[model samples]
Target: MSTKFNTFILTALASSSSFGLTPAASALPPVTAISGYSFTRSGMDLNYVAIEFDAAVLPFEVQAFVSKLGGCLAVPENGTDNFNAAISLVLIDTGAPEDNAAWLGIVHTPAGDGELHWSTIEGDSVYFLAFDKGGSSNSPEAPLGVALDAHSQQWFDVTLDDGSSNIRRAVLSFPASMLDCDADMIPDALVLALGLGEDQDGDGRLDWCAPAGDFNGDGIIGAADLSIMLANWGLGGETDLDADGTTGASDLAMLLAGWQQ
Candidate 1:
């Protein structure tokens, strides 16, 4: 995800009540780096990711963050990992840099967590940095080791200095099923469709990044898409472009703004 959004986008978001989350203030920090591991549950292979935001985000921040995504899901002990096309974020893969993906695999987070229907990405820098001290008492990875196992794949693995207090540390765990759109038995991919759907058509490649507000998946925001949104007005689902859980004035405004006409 981008460290920062452009002036116009940020300003517009600031004015809109589209997210419909609490506190009506910014809470979550920008994700700067990450790390990860793998696990199993009821025959399902899950992906786990350790997150390091630019700041020490609080618990409430997690809830607020999901509100931005249009809907929130509960995945018992796993946090909410599914990401729709509500917004953009950073994606990283521990096993393969090329496996780096977008969307939220960050399910139920005690602090940092989600399932991946799909999410969006505005920026990326996929790399692995490991500073494994192997049980050394003074290692920086010690505090963050739970999410960074010895045999796991990861993004960053270096010395966490006084500059790294880890108050910003959290984890993202998700089932491979949520992200294996490519059927590769792994969690990864990128969403170039900044203002569109998540993996539409399921061809992977995020449907090669669908056009803005192409709700019907016909590759454009046309009369049919607008009609669908209007039909669902005051409701939720894809028509709720702003992802506030209900199609209302904000969703209408966004749809109109992105209208192909």
Candidate 2:
């Protein structure tokens, strides 16, 4: 099993009434980079790239200094050793190399720890940073180590910007294993946002990434999800999984087909 952080703060925020986690907000589109938020993956690297928190979370002043907030996890391309199963994150300058902000206690894991889990990369240097273990010293609790033989499979360029419509990407590489790719690698935060659970295998892949008829995103198409579909019967939102621009009998039929899967 993979490690599970406290995630109390994130869960509270997620369950808040103000977030408007209706089907629309909860159903994360497949787009690589949106205007305000974007999370995508390539090979072993699941990139947060850029996360612009809404003004409701942080005031404008504190948010300005922040540029791109990126995190990545690398795993064996073939085997299941997951040598570098640990996840790490970094904050980069806003295209201005000299303006790199080294402020600690800013980036945090889902547990809301003051520090990132493993070593953080700044520029070309890698620094071994302590993990926020929520007052515990454990083995698996720590982030995964970087495999020495690991190297990036694909290249990514980060064109940093100051809150512009730019997506700055960060990549992590793994060993020279055969690339028989088969899963949609993504962060757990996105999984939870879509009502999926933690990565049970710790293999950097969610079991229910694209499950059919997950209208309510609770990982299942059940009564609650059906109710939502009925509520938005003729609308275009999360319930319209078919992208046919309507939530009618066709959509309802799909939900029924995948019930309790």
Candidate 3:
């Protein structure tokens, strides 16, 4: 697919289809210090849930649960035609486990209000799902009508409410394609934290998913890669993977090890 730049904002919503603020046409601010849950990238078709936190967002967390057996797309709220899309779910951790909930807010885009969207990073269409457990209440099934065998101890369906208002828990069904950025048969999330999808080259594209081992960042590990490494040899710089203050045989070995066979 051709490269196109898409802008997104970080907010306090847990649904990818939800963005609470205006979309900025710039690279997202860097993400530093994420805590709480483990981020794992997988190569097989399996079921797992990842709970992530961003220190920059303060008390907001994202929980991504994947079930290879089956998944669904996120649904729009009642009477609202706008589809809110987000790269990651923004949630509020209520200190108390029983009241914990994730919320999906409205999305703003250049094309008007729409769901949070991004080019398929992994090259597959991902099914999404959202449902209200009804504010402080628990439900065995989601209201959006998708059947999920929510057996993992890490997940629970809970709702947030203030007697008059209520919000629900959400889950996303992204295909294996969405997570694998390098096509090296590994999900990028497995190697780095979230926000690695930000645009870096100013080429109207995101370098977050750039393939690994392409030291020169030209999208390939070829002669240019070797040349670049050799040039940087004895000088600690881009080729210094070991970071021992110099690029030498050890760095060359590492570079060769990553050579695209």
Q: All models: lDDT?
A: 0.37, 0.32, 0.32
Top model by TM-score, which number?
Answer: 1
Off by over 4 Å in 1: 1-146, 150-208
**Better-scoring candidate (TM-score), 2 or 3:** 3
Ranking by lDDT: 1, 3, 2
lDDT of 3 at 130: 36
Better of 1 and 3 by TM-score: 1
Show the lowest summed lDDT stretch of 10 residues, model 1: 5-14
The residue-by-residue lDDT of candidate 1 on 43-72, one tens digit each, is 544544444444554323444554343222
Model 2 lDDT tens row, 192-261 = 3323344564433354454545655677668888887888989965566554667788878877877897
lDDT score of residue 15 within candidate 2 = 26
TM-score of each: 0.32, 0.26, 0.27
172-199: candidate 3 lDDT, tens digit per residue: 3333333333333223442233333444
lDDT winner: 1
Model 2 / residue 261 / CA error / Å: 2.0
